[model samples]
Target chain A: GESVGLHLPTLSVQEGDNSIINCAYSNSASDYFIWYKQESGKGPQFIIDIRSNMDKRQGQRVTVLLNKTVKHLSLQIAATQPGDSAVYFCAEIRGNTGKLIFGQGTTLQVKP
Target chain B: GAGVSQTPSNKVTEKGKYVELRCDPISGHTALYWYRQSLGQGPEFLIYFQGTGAADDSGLPNDRFFAVRPEGSVSTLKIQRTERGDSAVYLCASSPARNNEQFFGPGTRLTVL
Candidate 1:
């Protein structure tokens, strides 16, 4: 989902439920994509990353899926917990420049 | 192990004042980058450095903003005649290679009053 202005698109899920956050990227040549979690007053922490070559990459409790055809990516969190609540962002890096372009973040609100 | 660290975790300055934000990237990381993140928005690229030279500064908003990586490890972002709009979280990141996973530092929250 996309956001505008001062508001971020929010997703509400129950604790222990699976959560999926979707991001539509703009760059067609982007070879690398990463998922980051940001809590209040803190910097972004890396969750997982997926290269364009693979369609799916799984971590401990997280999985990243990249659909290069439509330029879409998604992050799935298994057994979402209360501490999992935070702002999630998807960033991509182009080939020429190492600069990362970040997508509008999605706020995940895990309810107990 | 120490990750990237930034000085002046929080900075407040009057408009038109000059400010310098420092970032110490992880040792041996060759590529460093600067980004600005405003409230409710994702971080925007500001600059990138390769070694002691600026690899790309096209992301910089204007000439008033400049960054330097003096020894290819420590970097400082300088903003002259700062305006209220300059208030945002400036984040610095580093990577082992040009196209690798980047490690980010706790951003320097700059508030131009």
Candidate 2:
């Protein structure tokens, strides 16, 4: 069975500080990993994604790191803001399949 | 352009009743997916469609759950004999293709009492 997991269920950070969220996946064949930010009463929004061949990828204010050797994934937000507060999820594209397996989300709270 | 959209922002029904949830994917999106999210949990995959065909339905929990993308533009998820455990937020997403970035809808909150 394919599984993706987060290292933490909740994280709190002060505004303007950097926040790091970690995830672990069990499928070695997973080639694509994506990060999604979900706000209350809304849908999951695409954050950033990393391919198995790459170790790192950067977006506007976010970065995703992948460690194939350890089957780990991480999302780093620089200078987190109050609006950055949301539940973040890590998902993987199962091999060549179109199906995506999502891990438990980590709620991030940026306090002012 | 409008993003993915779902109908019936919320639905409450009695257990054992039938229900239908609709999703309208972004125009020109080649792939669409359905997911179920439980309270405080990540969304779980339910089904995927490419064009008008169901590319994968393995994620569906049981025979009571079924989904259709008849015209490839709109999709509907139908659940029969719903149970209390079926209560959750049903989410819909669309991507240009497999492994592509997915854009999600606001979701249809389903409550089975």
Candidate 3:
């Protein structure tokens, strides 16, 4: 199936530690990828995005690395905080209509 | 500026009933999308609208599910004869034309019994 999936279902990190969430996608034609953070009752919020042409992208305290070779993608959060405790999702956009497909979420538990 | 908004944050319904979910995108956004997220799973694409017309309905699971954006700003997702399998969070997102950064609203949680 041409699906995007996460390598881990849950990740636990200390307040000051870095956190990494991984994703694997099967579609080679996928050109764009994004990472989103979703709180308990809110919709997923865009954190960062990287084009397939680029291998990496960085945001305020987060970084997204894309490895087209292994069809893998990762989101790295520096100095994880209690506010970062949420379900993170990765998404891909391709084709003409410009639809965004999301991957299974990985819950991040940041302990203070 | 206000972000996207969805009406009736939560809905509880019985099988074989009908329900409607509404979405109001950020002002000036031209592209709108609908998605369904089940527990422990990601959001699945349901439909996409550009302007007042639906550009893609390929992701709709069945004919029972339908949506429309009449004025190109507000949209509605209608489900007929809802089934238990239809229980999930319905999400609405919108972007400015071809902009890839989609702003999503707090999804409407639908519970079917």
Backbone clashes under 3 angstroms, per model: 0, 0, 0
Model 3 off-target regions past 4 Å?
Answer: none
Give the candidates in order of TM-score, highest first: 3, 2, 1
Q: What residue pairs clash in candidate 2, if any at all?
A: none
> What tens digits encode model 3's per-residue C-alpha lDDT throughout B1-113?
99999988999999999999999999999999999999988899999999999999999999999999999999999999999999999999999975468999999999999
Question: After TM-score superposition, what is the CA distance of residue B40 in candidate 2 from its true location, in Å?
Answer: 1.1
lDDT of 2 by residue, B1-113 (tens): 89999999999999999999999999999899999999999999999998999888888999999999998899999999999999999999999997788899999999999
TM-score of each: 0.94, 0.97, 0.98
DockQ of candidates 1 onward, in order?
0.74, 0.78, 0.80
TM-score of chain A of 3: 0.97
lDDT of 1 at B28: 97
- List where candidate 2 sits over 4 angstroms from the true fold: none
Please say which candidate is ahead in lDDT: 2 or 3: 3
Q: Candidate 1 docking: what grade? A: medium
